[model samples]
Target: MPSVPLHSSATPIVSAVLAFDVGGTDTKAGLVLSAAPGEVPEIVDIQRFRTALDAQRPGPVLVDFLDGLLRRYATEHPQLRIAAVGVTVPGLVDEQRGIGIYAANLGWRDYPFRAELESRMQLPVSFGHDVGAAGDAEVALGAGQGAENAMILVVGTGIAAALYIDGRRLRAGGYAGEVGHAMAPAPDGGLQIMEATGSAGAIGRRYLLAHPDFSGGAREVLTLAKAGDTVAQRIWAEAIAALAFSIAQAVAMIGISKVVIGGGLAEAGDELFEPLAKQIDQLLSFQPRPVLVKAMLGQNAGLIGSALKAQELLSAASSEPSTGALP
Candidate 1:
């Protein structure tokens, strides 16, 4: 619900765009209306649907869902012109080719999303990595506004990163920001990757493995840790350690000025940030410690990002330069 009040009820809606964010477990579609002067753009008529997917071949189902939504919106809002469509999905994405290179959760490989969406909708399409697009919104409209070199690190069922360096996003064919896979010291005295040890899903999975009766995720695990459960404490500590190690590495390599944490685990607030900050300080020597902050746009960042993508598409097609700000 990104909204701003218009001054007058008589003012007409200038235009709107269709935006879809295909997340791991759900898909969200909404209409992003362009704001008139002195008003903020808003995402209205939002719909959330459980992602009904076929892991091996997700494109057809996804495309069908999007098309239906688009048609419905068109019928519902006849007054506003929908200029473009933006779709973002989790996975390795090649923005230049408009291909979803791969997604571990969704299990699609090299799917030509832009071509499929364009063929059906007949509109200018913008496609990108889900976390990357969310990062764009954060940079432009949230915590990362003034930073030249920053990162948006999303720790959820899995982990991914969006790198902004030299004041521009680094796609590198969608291979630039897979930091979750980086190696870290495991709590069991061996090496493990950050995602396996630190992600919200990983933390829950680890705790569940330790105590089969515990029917909850990282949140419950954190609660148990605070209540003096040794098993939960160990698991929570490992998650923190793994995350801190990975972040310090990014700071060393890229000199990241700010790391805007997003996704479910960020919901933990101080429990995640405080210890992660302390550990990161312990790890870095010469590298400047990046400022760690929670994402301001919350879960809506990706959706807003999709809207921004659509707006940009329309702007480009009409030969109008886009400022890349959130609509």
Candidate 2:
């Protein structure tokens, strides 16, 4: 979405907060404003930017980028008070400490993300893992809304999961949901990471290996499979099988009742779900199978999750005693 100016003469300014969701390839930021105390926050000025790839000094680069964005928003909306900021990024995050422990793609380690941003902006900040945050949103308002124990699997370029058990999010210090690394059977009759066999990127890579001249992605491969291309059909079937095996393992371990699938691969709809559900059913003997569903929030789930976090921060601040007030 295109960025909108913070202030407009025709639009009334209201209390607002800032939220950012940083992904591997792009970053999405939003300005959430509340028109009424009980109304849902209105999201505006949604914008996307290329993610910063400064591996050498990712801390400073990220801080600078966030600072610049905050400065611009403040400049444009002088009357609007941004009570808090929420940032969600991929990889391991120590949310309680506001530290980004590690992101292999971004090349950041033990980065004090929240402290740096809060020091610069003088505002409360909330930090979390991207998939975790997205899963929270799903539980609170999306596909997993009514499910107490749900697992959200994001199967795009890579595969990751957000696990909720008995209505509680299981972070495990950002290591709980790295299902992509789980073991799965490879075509060579050996074990490999589940992502290598099931993820959308994996499908594209495997297809390219077989047909180097087929310059298409996972979606294209699915299309070809639908048209009865034997190679594409084989690759797609393997992906579904691997994904189903992983889901079955998760169910056996955690008793998750609902599985919400999202990301680019989920776009295949019943083409992916029917086979996956059937496979899981065949794999499980005594264990109860989960109801597989698609993610309802689409790509905006992370951004919504960030806004929810900011609202929580704002509420906490409001309930705290004023330290600088005259008694």
Candidate 3:
């Protein structure tokens, strides 16, 4: 979905479809439906649950969970005929092969996700990366709209980006957006991982490490920084700098026209973007400074992306009217 081209029209489908986005903390499910013919499906009835991944064998466990979910939905929404499924998960994925190559927290490697789901559920399954899916939604209907070249950064528990150049997403075999692991300047004059100094999770974690007595997360840390807490201020500033460095790196390589910031950190509003913009300016020389914008799709972008994939699959397989590909 990330680089599948920007589609703003309807997917040819006559039935309801299931879209699932599996996150580190929770798994989200939604039903997508088109109110009328020739319209994009509206994602509705969103639900979430604690993600339970078995370290030894996540494939079967996930399939079973999905099967149960399908049954529950069938019972709950009996009038609707469920046709296909589109699922997105985090980590390194092979979209073409429909394989989940690796996920450290999800504890899976080289798992045949699409095959297993289709074989078990007897429904067509469209699989992709979670962040990529989110990026797809952002581009299609969210803040990244109308941007020809951009980076959609999702800085949650971890950090990843969805790079769009010339209005096409750069998949790079699902390894394109692992910015959190990229090296950055550290306070100690040594290089540290970007997520260690940035990322919403890292911001709170580093603050807690510095002040064990603190009892809140990144929002609280930002508040403390505003109140002149030196430790909080330092942590916050370093996080911003790390993000700027990573964004600058992306700009240097591809000349992004806009940076759409999403995930938990983006909720900080001006607290994150204003300083991030300033730091990035200080780091750049002659590059076109990219406009920083917040993601408008909230946290359900992946669900929307997945649903779009499901509808697209249905359209491709059936005689439903669809806008095949639109730039």
For model 1, residues 98-195, the per-residue Cα lDDT tens digits are 99998877778888989998898888889988899899888878877878899999999889999999999998998989998888988888998889
Overall lDDT per candidate, in order of appearance: 0.86, 0.87, 0.85
Instruction: List model 2 lDDT by residue over 104-149, tens digit each.
Output: 8888999999999888878878888898888888888789887888
lDDT per residue as tens, model 3, 1-327: 466657646543346788899877789998887545333457667899787778888877887888788778767776667888889999998888999998888888899999999888888899999888888878887899889898999998889988899989888887888888999998678999999889889899999998888889899999999999999999999999999999999999888879999999999999998999999998888998999999988888888878777777777877656543311
**Span of 10 residues, lowest total lDDT, candidate 1:** 318-327
lDDT of 2 at 259: 98
Going through the candidates in the order shown, the clash numbers are 0, 0, 0
Best-fitting candidate, measured by TM-score? Answer: 2
Rate residue 271 of model 1 by lDDT: 95
For the record, the alpha-carbon RMSD of candidate 3 to the native fold, in angstroms, is 8.3
Q: Where does candidate 3 stray beyond 4 Å?
A: 1-14, 35-41, 319-327
Query: Total clashes, candidate 3?
Result: 0
What TM-score, over all chains together, does every model reach? 0.90, 0.92, 0.90
Model 2 stretches astray by more than 4 angstroms: 1-12, 35-41, 77-79, 323-327
